[model samples]
Target chain A: QCSLDSVVNKRIQEALKEYKPSIPTKTLSCVSITSSGRLSSCPAGMVVTGCACGYACGSWDVRGTTTCHCQCSVIDWTTARCCHLA
Target chain B: QCSLDSVVNKRIQEALKEYKPSIPTKTLSCVSITSSGRLSSCPAGMVVTGCACGYACGSWDVRGTTTCHCQCSVIDWTTARCCHLA
Candidate 1:
């Protein structure tokens, strides 16, 4: 008689070895922008700005040479506003 | 005299409006392959086979014309093995 348990175990192992997982073909990237131009990171909670911007409760202030006490929430920080020198 | 509060508030609003968030430039895609050929969704916890395959305690058996009792955890289901006709 064929051992059902052994047969199943063998099949399971074979299937596991012959399996191949997929990965995202395309990459997922995002950008961040400030009032001036572009920035590295943004304040916590606050999004990049514009795209889905908001103010974070705790985070470093955007770098720039402006006394403007404002925050931006952008979608892509790559092309987001950075700073202005007026 | 300029009110610090008003100045800050005005700047904040302007910055908020002109803000924009960043998104993943590249798409993150994955493929899934089965012992047979390809399949749709797989069991939970168990990834697709090969790439990062595994078995789930609860889930429908992959569709196919085979009695192979095995599970796969694939990354992308687009090209994951489906079933066999033996």
Candidate 2:
């Protein structure tokens, strides 16, 4: 039984050595999505990190965790800074 | 030899079962850092995903991969939307 356990431990260690290299190294990736209106949204599987607005409007908010809505009344465009794990 | 191989394979499977739950499930975490000037930066180990500025200024760019630089002639504040995997 002792010899069996030792052999199993050695095999497990070797298997782990093989498996460690297959683990993924994930990174952050982002993109900008702009629309010719007051609101813009990120694509599926992405989240909005921030927003930009036209007409020099600094006021904005995120809606539903995905869309950017510029608060200025006369805004012509909106941009969503979208990001995801890549 | 065949019996030893079978025992080793069973042990490897059990070891993998124990290890799978220990793997980290990474997610995206973000924060907004606001400063009382034209520039703001993310903390170390974080990256800038986007930026915001005061005085209704929408023109801006990232300086380095961590800092947000507002480009308006008169800016009172800057916000860096920083993110990282957690």
Candidate 3:
């Protein structure tokens, strides 16, 4: 049987290879708002991930902003809650 | 109700504000190995996030590197499998 190790190691190598060290804040030169208008992003290479809220609320109209209420009537509504990843 | 929408929106604002744009590769000044040694990180503001593997395997030594084998003997063995974040 093929050793599971090879598969595991392959993944490890992949993660390590994909890992991109972050840039320091002092040197970052540019920051811009995303087209969605909800979140901003770094154009260069210092894109930040894992930065998100517990949930998203409200609705977005044709304008770049959400049109729904910025508040939820109940607790933990998946669809009603806005989840943004950028 | 206090309004879940407000809570959701508050989180949204927090995420948008925390979003950090990346720096251009041309301007990136430095790159170095992390203290852990397995992953490299950017020293500047352009830190990459959401870059991780699905699992973690093996063991890690007090030393910056993991001591575990890069392989899993069984399928979907969470402990035997290695998942990395960073």
Candidate 4:
């Protein structure tokens, strides 16, 4: 019984040493709108709306000027934005 | 004034047609533990703990078997898992 208790104690210690909380390293990037009233190309992780370039590029919104929204839904790459419409 | 009203109506119509809600395409991956009491490699955009493989590989947790948590933090690539420890 004493030996079993010792083994259990060792296992508990090992478990304590081995346990680690999961922390996510990757972060999502934010979307941006361009000044020319056009949507811009988003970086790899980001999606472009209303912008005329990059992934998921298309007309997203129109007002006095074309307003576009670029967003990154992924976690690895940082988001980016650029304009193409004139 | 009548011309202004027609132009305004046309603009409203265009605005209605142009509006699109922002939708994210990328999704985050889930974490998992391996059968060998070790952590498996997580695909891109995922964080792994316990199982020992791939990026950010290390011990994440242990029980009857070693279990690792793998997740994808980025958006471009789908998450993957593999075991390295025996």
**Top candidate by lDDT:** 2
**Tens-digit per-residue lDDT, A3-50, candidate 2:** 998978887777676674456879887777888899999999999877
The stretch of ten residues in a row with the least summed lDDT in candidate 2 chain B is B16-25
What is the C-alpha lDDT profile of model 1 across B1-86, one tens digit per residue?
A: 24644554455455545545443443112223333322344433323321112222112253333221333343222222211111
In Å, residue B31's CA in model 1 sits off its true spot by: 1.8
List TM-scores for all candidates, in order: 0.23, 0.69, 0.16, 0.22
DockQ values of all predictions: 0.01, 0.40, 0.04, 0.01
Candidate 2: CAPRI quality band: acceptable
List per-prediction Cα lDDT, in the order shown: 0.30, 0.84, 0.29, 0.33
> TM-score of model 3 relative to the true fold?
0.16
Q: Report the C-alpha lDDT of model 1 over A3-23, residue by residue, as the tens digit.
A: 644554555555446544333
Tell how far residue B23 is off in model 3, in angstroms. 19
Write candidate 3's Cα lDDT for A22-82 as tens digits. 5654433323233332333333433222211113422111112222111223323211111
Give the higher-DockQ candidate: 3 or 4.
3
RMSD of 3: 28.6
- List where candidate 1 sits over 4 angstroms from the true fold: A1-86, B25-28, B34-86
Better of 1 and 2 by lDDT: 2
* TM-score (C-alpha) between model 2 and the true structure: 0.69
